[model samples]
Target: MPYSRHLGPLTPPAWHRPWFRYIDAVPGAEGAPPAPDPAQSAQTPPADPPAEPVDYKAKYEEAIGHSRQWEQRAKDNKAKADKFDAAEQEKLSEIEKANLRIADAEKASAAVAAELLQLKAANANGITKDERALLTGTTEDELKAQVAAILKLRAPSTASAQDAGITGGGSAAPTSRAKTLAEAVAARINKK
Candidate 1:
């Protein structure tokens, strides 16, 4: 009788719902497929979430490729920077050397001037005779020779306009050969 609560033993699960209850109650209907037992499905648990797909080969290759590129670029940049730094250091060294040369020349010129002044002061008649004589030394003659040599070394070359007869600060167009030779000889003596 309990099973007869339905029109028959075989009925669709959908027909057992309230919305479809009218279908079962229809007067001359035979029956439908039997509903599945709920206990059969209850014993099993729900499935786990789907796993993410992996591409190990692709990921490994990409990581290695990027690392190599980074290492190469790092080496290249370091080499370039070192090259420029070395060049810069060389340039700085050259400039320092030039500056040292200029400083030495200036100091030499100043010392020559100071020695000339001392010689002049020593020879001055205004000083006491005893103090003036006490200033006697080879310093005055030696400094005079050095100054003359420096002046001769710094003089204009033989090819200057003065020697080329080019007018304006130059020798006259008609200057005698003897005059030129005399000038050269005089420069040589002064330089010695």
Candidate 2:
């Protein structure tokens, strides 16, 4: 006559239901080999295969960044070289032009000097011609007399010691003096 038990009217507890369902659902899986519990397995913990090695993404990123920096430096160097080359070319062209101008100036100076020399010579010749023409206006007899007087004044005396013993054939003619005068006259006339 304690409190009447209600076991007959109550449904089964839910705690045991899942266990029963697992046991019933996996009877073939359990029969195969107890499923080899992970904790009890002797597979040597799989040795972790050397931990798959780290990716080192940061180090690779740093190396790539350095490479990019070096590339930029190379580009800058090339640009500088290009600029220098262009400037050098311009300087060279300027130098070439200067040389050409200098050459041209030298040629012009030479031409001018030649022309000046030619003009001076022409003026000299013109003056000489004018002097000669002015001298022609004098009396012919007077000019002849002056030339004869100059020749007589310049002639060696026949009694001079150098001419005294110099005698020609038979008549002792003044052949040597005449021949010398003739040669001088011929030379002077040829010079004209």
Candidate 3:
């Protein structure tokens, strides 16, 4: 026995009901032929056609499954792209840090070289620890010039006397010699 929706006895599909006409149901469809007149339809009626059952639910399910598979592929591709971007960013940061370290090392190296040059210059010029700060210049010629200036300013102090022996341009009369420091002081006051 065949399954039937109604509780009554099974009836043949041909005797069940008349099939609806698609063209007559929806009017004014674009590029469709005009609906036939009732008089003309009666004179030449369409022949009866058997209806075939269609699995619409199965078709809808198949479409949904296909769509899900594509969505999953898209998500996987996005994940791979995100991972690639993250790795690239990390590499770039490490390279940037390395560059900064190189720059710092270069700065330190330059400072040491300059300090060594200054030490060499000070030692060659016989500059003392106290006078080391007085020296200044980046090149050999400039350093030598500074050294010459320093030496000129630091010349022996004995070259000049604190008090003059003679003050006037004219010859003076001979004076008597004092025997003691007290006598010399008394003589200077008396002369004045």
Clashing residue pairs found in predicted model 1: 10-32, 11-33
Best by lDDT: 3
- In terms of TM-score, how similar is model 2 to the real structure? 0.22
Backbone clashes in candidate 3 total: 0
Tens-place lDDT per residue, model 1, 1-192, is: 235554566455674675764435444345655665689779877778777899999999999999999999999999999999888767777779799899999999987776566567545423444433333223555434434433343455556555555655645453444354455456446545
Which 10 residues in a row give candidate 3 its minimum summed lDDT? Answer: 173-182
- Residue 134: error of model 2 in Å? 84
**Candidate 3: tens digits of C-alpha lDDT, residues 1-192:** 565455566655654566733334354475456776889889984697777899999999999999999999999999999999888768777779799899999999987876677689889878788867755555566567656655554554332221222453333433222123234344335534
In candidate 2 the C-alpha lDDT for residue 28 amounts to 40
lDDT of 1 at 68: 100
Rank order by TM-score, top first? 3, 1, 2
Predictions: Cα RMSD each: 30.5, 41.3, 34.3
Instruction: Between candidates 1 and 3, name the one with more favorable TM-score.
Output: 3
lDDT of each: 0.60, 0.56, 0.64
What lDDT score is found at residue 57 in candidate 2? 100
Per-prediction TM-score:
0.25, 0.22, 0.33
Clashing pairs in 2: none
Candidate 2 lDDT over residue span 155-191, tens digit each: 7856444454445334455455555556545544553
